[model samples]
Target: MLGLNKTDSKFLLIVILLTLFTPFLMQPFAADSGLDQFNGGYPDLMQKVAIFGIFAVGFNILFGLTGYLSFGHAAFLGMGSYAAVWMFKLLTMNVIPAILLSMIVSGLLAVIIGYISLRRSGIYFSILTLAFAQMCYKMAYSVLTPITNGETGLQLSLSDPRILDGATESTSLPVTNIFGLAMNSSYKLEALNRVFTFNVGFYFCAVIAIIAFYIAIRLFRSPFGMMLRAVKSNQTRMNYMGLNTKPYTLAAFVISGMYAGLAGGLLAAMDPLAGADRMLWTASGEVVIMTILGGAGTLMGPVLGAGVIKYLENIFSKINESVLHSWFHWLPDGLEEVVVWVFARFTGEGWHLTLGLTFMLVVTFLPGGLVEGIKRLKKLTKRGGKPKDKLDAPDPEHTPTPSKHVV
Candidate 1:
């Protein structure tokens, strides 16, 4: 519909619908009800879902298409965040310039890292990227204190020179905006005694994510994408065919890095802060988890994974014994205590344990991630009680009677 094939068009439409209706999707627990604690429709969490979705989508281009597992892509994200915050500090409070600078700076950094890391493949390549990322984190935390502000993070100040705009006249820190529209601006919709928040920041990130997804779809169907898949399947074969595969792989790595950077920029744009912790290896690993858990090679898998993980982090982490008890209060006293104890391990401070278990299940049962699982379920349902393959269907022409079998 929008210069896309039927599949791409449909995918885009689904994304648009989901993004628009995310408030209802994430907050099915009912407002001010006993399950209200499970609601995740707030602006901050919604912004996160969009931002991380971009990050995971970008990572999929490399890890999914090229089969290049990078442990350092988070460096680009951190770099983008730092660049964005600097833009906010030096330029106007507008987010456009900051976002632009972040992409450029992160892309440049990715090119450098990719060039060096692409020399080796397999574990060697992974280690090289990991080293680079860790070095960046260490430098930012120690030697780059002037730029990164060390442990305190980079924040907007009233004294800084903003050439595009005059000094900040307000007493407090300036809020990021696009011209007259504040990033934090939101509209509340009340329906049937429930409140739903529609935030400008979430929509801004959603628009960018949709664009990114569309681009990804185009890339997946392009000749270049075929080359990346070829590179993933048999790089040796490509090399033997006299194809310079290194350049192709390097290009994918750089592109993926730029995607990560763009995500980082969006995060800073939403929150207007940059910290060394953002570049940590754990953060990079989280994107890896998101991509793998969602279905690394598929278009919608990464986005789904990001949303799931973010929800778990934000919602499950809030559960306490009191909340657990409330839900199990209907059961017998002894049984309720046991059930709450068991459930408590998966929520609140132990949310990571639940995430780990889910990751393990996905990996063990659906190596292709949640997408493959969904596909399997669909296939099973389509088959009904019949066998899965066409081989089970009788063919009169192919089947010989016992009397004519010998002949």
Candidate 2:
């Protein structure tokens, strides 16, 4: 886990804040002014943020706990998504079945995969899994075209027979009316013509994110988690101590795969579409990036890393000089021009460049990642907070000691 330095503590606090109040934070009137630009609401993006957070959290369970880098975790995620979509087509539109089926399918897949891959460790295991994932991907894209819908992706077809709880074929549920709140509304400041959208999809994601965070926290504190960490630090040592590291490692792998599946299911449940592209090797790498960027071993780091990545993707890419011009209308033209240009360079098509640079800088300077950087900053601040004073300070014996006698 990222060292429990003050900065890391703040990182935990930030995750808690974001996940807990995500709905309000996404609203226009909330503390963050960036919300006003969205007229349709941020719920759609929020759903994605939550799903990815779930994905990263699950990945951390493997790499963070056992230090095993399979590099094919996305296979489970993709499989889960397909399973979820199938569930939607066959059963009711309710997410419970989709999520459950996703986990079960992923669990089975992981069992077979881990059994084979775990025979070897390190790069060999990673390559073995990668080969397997690629094999699966090709099958889904071609031979299994009928099942995967050939690359156009799977969708909810009313034509399909939902044999289980038929949820009125005519009515596909609206984007999660969780508490029945109208999620598609927008708040407008008429005079300024500013609008803040409230997307229903975002709330659905936020709630799920909160639940995922809680689960991660519990995992970090559990005895199983301790054993997993031991396996990572030194598997031989654990084995020498009579602990069967194999069982622990295998369990962690399966658990992590299940997590990836859950994330995938959520993605499909939020929007009834499952694509084979999600199983690509690049997608697996993305999860690794998320885990590392946030601080691999820390519970909250993965979520933070995921949010940061998604934010850059959705919020950062959408940014341009013109958007900046609108945002900085309150500033003078020359100053606005400079600010807009500088800010725009960090976004748009080259957003990946900015993320890569930021990631590199953090890794180089902090090594421990963003969580570590915060810790260093907090230590410095704490040191600075103390008022000037020398140790012993002469004990005040040489002066001012006579003042207390009168009182």
Candidate 3:
């Protein structure tokens, strides 16, 4: 760890507090209110939050550090998912090989794509990546049937041959296991007079998410990370300094692609299916949204953003007529019908519109994302903290003082 004084200590304390408190902040959404008409539980959604957190973290390395916006990153993610599913089909359901194969395949794909895409920079680079991704999607949906399984999505079936010896000839995809420790999809819980059940997969994802966070933190502090930051701040200057920035940028791209691959592999581990939808442009855009929404260039911000978006996608869209009836029927006959009519439009297909509006508002008001907004609110209201001890304060010893107190 970098040596730090009292100011840095306070900043670290705040971060620790936020991390410890975030689950509590998110606890209300996790509960089975009438809102949880479907599969609404902290454990289940937390898995999604973690997996996509891996995804957005990967994207941040490229877009955040290298300042290279990629529109094809999801293609790598899809390839990884497909690879992971195929591993499950042909080998053991243990996630180790699945995850490794997924990462390797995605890295190889990134090498090819990044080589071509890196030829151009700025908007042209982004367009090149986009075009490549669209090509991948098209091939998956059409000519790549043997590999990708096309439209209906690639599914794990026992009919497929397994070359791996000692592997189970499974009718169902092998249950998630390590060595011999089986990971089931169901866990029991009792709360008040109610009973609850959830999946072990959720906890697996949570553990992985913490690992992902630790990796991102290490990357943010490494010298390589600082060089990547320099590239973002001034590419021409870095070039003039005789640094071959291309290799660094390409490495970042591949690394990020692999992170996306890990995320996709995790998804496949949970579901044992791969879909062309994983390669969609919207999927790529989701990472960008996640990074910016959570706070671009800030550790843990993208995870927060991914959780917010996914929570909305799943829970925010489940309000149907029955859900409406259960809610406002107690009001009165006339008011209930009218209220349902109005609210129903905002659910189902209308969820995207609602999200779009939320995106617009967030971007317009908090361009630095929710993290920045929270920072501002803290500064404005929390007068208890000293300004000199603020997290973003410049290092005092490093700062040029008029006095010759070099010691």
| Candidate 3 stretches greater than 4 Å from native | 1-43, 163-173, 193-198, 330-338, 384-407
The TM-scores, one per candidate, come to 0.94, 0.79, 0.84
Across residues 1-407, which tens digit of lDDT does each residue of candidate 3 receive?
A: 33434654465456445444333434443345553344445555656777898899889888888889998889988999999988877877787788889999999999999989998899999999999999999999999998888998989775655456355555554565645555555656655433454556766666676666667777877899999999889988998999988899999999999999989998888778899999999899888888888888887678778878888888768776787788887888988899988887777667777777778888999988878878877886786656446566777878776787678
- What is the model-wide C-alpha lDDT for candidate 1? 0.91
Instruction: Give one digit per residue, the lDDT tens place, for model 2 in 23-140.
Output: 5555544334665444223666667778899999988988887889989998999999999889878766667777889999998999999988988889998999898788778878
Residue 144, model 1, lDDT: 96
Q: What is the TM-score (0 to 1) of candidate 3?
A: 0.84
- The sequence of per-residue lDDT tens digits that candidate 1 reaches over residues 57-155 is 999999999999999989999999999999988988899998889989999999999999999998998899999999999999999999999999988
Among all candidates shown, the one with the greatest TM-score? 1
Which regions of candidate 2 deviate over 4 angstroms?
1-17, 26-41, 165-200, 324-345, 385-407
Local distance difference test, per candidate?
0.91, 0.77, 0.79
Q: Find the candidate with the highest lDDT and give its number.
A: 1
Which candidate, 1 or 2, would have the higher lDDT against the true structure?
Answer: 1
Query: Which sequence of candidate numbers ranks them by TM-score, best first?
Result: 1, 3, 2
